[model samples]
Target: MPYADVNGMSLYFEEHGTSEDTVPPLVLLHGGFGAGEMFQPLLAAGLGEGRRVITVDLQAHGRTPDVVGRPMSMEAMADDVAGLVKELGLPAVDVLGYSLGAGTAARLAVQHPDLVHRVVLVSMPARREGWFPGVRAQMDAMHEGAADALKQSPMYELYERLAPRPEDWPVLVEKVASMNRRDYDWTEELSGVTAPVLLVFADADGISPAHMVEFYGLLGGGHKDPGWDGADRPASRLAVIPGATHYDLMFSPLLVPVVRSFL
Candidate 1:
């Protein structure tokens, strides 16, 4: 029930775990059309055992109301996150974002390096073209009325349950669809990110394996095997969880360990 007046919006967020000094806090960003509660499984799986976990509902998602004039862009969302971090009085924090959140987190690391210590991206691609052909095609087909079209879906039900203004679901959907239509390629920005990163995705994710490898390469990974004593280890880590897809990757039992190891 906490809201932070940040970046021209009242953003909602929740905190979990004890305030332990040895472990750094983690800022969790959820996927598109989803809220902070989407991470409940991971939260229940002890992701916050030794650390503090903070989950946020981005603009127009979950308990947060839509921003009147701001179109949802990864850059603007990242700025909102940075503003929240500043408001929280944290010098820096580790960030873990999925799908839409992942892209936003990447932007955060690239644009506000001082606010992030490390980052984890799940089911996110550095470039718009990194998504598989079918996925891209599906995205291209989205229109302003998409939310009304999906009113019978479970996502709509969840939105109605959590949105500050449940009737605005259609508006949120339209804004997201509009944002998705915009072209973007953040390969250069990814290369410039100074924080160590963990790239996680499903074996059958929306991104092609080749593109995943290319993304890892840009992050200084996949060039060579780590030598003895791990001297040649890359700062970034990549994990492709078996038998998982974009929709289920976050719920995979394999996710927690991989994330913990990298963090």
Candidate 2:
């Protein structure tokens, strides 16, 4: 129930783990239409055992109400995260984001390198086109009336249960849909990120395998097989968990160990 007045929004966040833990905190950013609670499976798996875990509800999502005039964008969400870090008086923290949150995390690492120590990007593509054509088409369909159409879905139910203002569901949906319609390319900016990164996705994710490899290559990974001596290994790590998909990877059993190992 804690709210940080940041970046023109009342950003809601929760902290887990003991302050006595030695490891830096990990900030968990959820995907589009998801709240921080979506990471409960990972949290229950002890991802925060030796570290603090910070989870946030991004603009117009979960407990945080949308700013009246500010449209949601990755850049703006990243700024809000940076501001939250500052407000919390932390020097730096590790960031883990999924899908929409992944894009925001990537932008955070690029725009505020000094505030990020490590990054975990889950089910995110480097560019809009990295998603399969049909996936992209599905994303394009999230227009104004999509909220009403999705009322019977779990996402809508979750929002209704958790949002500060359940009546704002349609408004939130419209904002998210509007944001989705915009195109973006973060390839150039991603190349400049200095933090060590871990890219994770399901084998059957929305992103194509070729695009996944391409994304890894941009992160200085997948260029060559690591020598037996481990001398030529890439700083970044790539993990494609079997039997998982974009919508369910967060709850996948394979996610925690991979994330813990990388961090």
Candidate 3:
């Protein structure tokens, strides 16, 4: 029931494990059309041990209501998170983001380097063009008219149950679609990201493996073999969850274990 007035909306958040932490809070950001509840199962499995875990419901998602006339975009969501971090008075925190939230998390780290210590980007592309052509087509196809069709999805059911204004599902769809319409390329921004990062992808993800390696390179990874002395390894790392696709990767048990080990 904790809500922070962030960027003109009531941004809802929940804390788990020890409320206070010297290890820095682990902020979990969910994919597009998902709420923080998406992470509940993993947290319930004890993923938050020894650290404070914070799950945030992004703007217009979950318990948070959409503000009139505000179109959803990566930048906007990132700014909202930055506001939330500042509002909470967290000097620095670790971030784990998936898909839409990944983009937001990356942008937050890029824009406010001092606020983010380490980052984990799951199933997210460095740039909009990193997705497969078919995935791009599907993303671009999202619209309000597709709302009824989307009802068949579990995401829609989650929305139907938890959204403050379930009747505005169509509006949410249109906003996401609108945000997808814009082109975002953060190639340069990512290369200069100061914080150490972990780029995680599924073996059969929407993003190609070639692109995943390229993303790793941007964070100073996969360029050359690290010395056996373990002195020359890049702070950044890459992880691929076998037998998982973007849709199911979030739910994969391996996902939490990898993230828990990393962060």
Candidate 4:
């Protein structure tokens, strides 16, 4: 129930573990459609004892007040996050972000590199030219309930295959609806980032498998296959999660170890 007023918005946050000197802290930035509590189960399932976790509700989502400025770009969100970290008096913290959150994380690294010790981007898309227009169109059509639109969306297909349940659809729909359609660019910020990054993706993620690979490559991060080759880049790495789709990747058991290794 704790909230910090940042830039005219009430940002809600939850903390876990002990904030002692022995334990380093981790910040969890959810996808645009997700809330701070999305990672709740991970906290209880033994994410280690000495680590502290801070989960936040990004603007206009969950318990946070909507950010009325600049149509919700990743840069704008990153500013809000930076302000929150300062308010909390954290000198530096590791960041773990998924999908939309990944984009925000990239912006944060570029804009405020000093505030982040490490960064992780999961299920992200490339910011290159002409990469995501088709994907965004499909999602828009589905959002408007166009005929067979849902069937056409790779996101919906992946979600069905991975997290299909009567109750899950509503949550998914709500989250997608929360996205600010104007703020979805990350290409400009990727190259300027100097922080160590861990890029993760699922083989079956219909939403952005190809774009993810492209993004991985642009970061000078080396993928096992078909991604950017950064054999010489000392601070970046790419890992593909087998047998997992995008939705499934969120709940995958490997997330902890993957994120922990990077931190």
Q: Is candidate 1 or candidate 4 better by TM-score?
A: 1
Q: Which pairs of residues collide in candidate 1?
A: none
Query: Candidate 2: which stretches are off by over 4 Å?
Result: 19-22
Error of 3 at 238 (Å): 0.4
Residue-level lDDT of model 2, residues 1-263, one tens digit each, is: 69999977899999988655456789999999889998887888988777888999999998999889888899999999999999999999999999999999999999999999999999999999999999989879877687788888899888998898988888888888888888999899898888999999899999999999999999999888789999999889999999999988888888899998998
Model 4 C-alpha lDDT per residue in residues 34-94, reported as the tens digit of each score: 6777778777765534788888877655666554333556777888889989999988888
- Which residue runs of candidate 1 sit more than 4 Å off their true CA positions? none
lDDT of 2: 0.91
Name the regions of candidate 4 deviating beyond 4 angstroms: 19-23, 68-70, 128-134, 142-185, 207-210, 223-233
Work out the TM-score per prediction. Answer: 0.97, 0.97, 0.97, 0.76
> Where's the lowest-lDDT run of ten residues in candidate 4?
162-171
Quality of model 3 by C-alpha lDDT: 0.89
**Looking at candidate 3, what is the lDDT of residue 170?**
92
* lDDT digits (tens) for residues 24-117 of candidate 3: 8889999989999898888877767778888999877888899899888878888888898899899999999999989989999998888999
What's the best-to-worst order under TM-score?
Answer: 1, 2, 3, 4
lDDT of each: 0.91, 0.91, 0.89, 0.69
lDDT of 1: 0.91
